[model samples]
Target: DNYNAINVDRTEQIPMDYTGVMGVPITFLHKYNPRQFEIVDGLNRYTVLDVAGLNDNAVKNHLHMTEIGGKSTYFRVLIKNRKVKK
Candidate 1:
């Protein structure tokens, strides 16, 4: 289940300036408050991806592909904050 763990390094640096869709670590769910954020489809959800207008390349770049031991890892939960934190 480590693969599904929250990536602290990346999550800690999440930008508060953006209001659009964002990909976050699944661990974010631990502290998630539904009233504050909305869960969107993840990378594996093709239908949702199409609706979100995210292609393979865009998703890879936007998600900030990470490498572990030289292999790319995929573990994210797409989300959108109901209210952007100032």
Candidate 2:
């Protein structure tokens, strides 16, 4: 459960068994607002494992939002174990 050594900024973000992702969103603040899941964030409202299965396409530079105090605020986060420069 302690993924802090990795990309902890990815709220509610758990690891998965896949070929790994190439890129992920870049959020502003390191903190997030879980209360504003729907309006604030554009995420699938499901676990990381759930979304990747639905859309296999590249989602680089995408926009996401999370809610707080009944308000939806846009935020972007990092996707770990990504493609490193060769």
Best by TM-score: 1
**CA lDDT scores, all candidates in order:** 0.55, 0.31
Q: Highest lDDT among the candidates is held by which one? A: 1
lDDT, candidate 1, equals 0.55
Q: Tell me the TM-score of each prediction against the true structure.
A: 0.53, 0.20
lDDT by residue for model 2 (1-86), tens: 11111223344453443233212234433433344221122233222443434223323323222322334333333243332223
For model 2, the stretches where C-alpha displacement exceeds 4 angstroms are 1-65, 78-86
- Superposition error at 70 for model 1 (Å): 13
Estimate the TM-score for candidate 2.
0.20
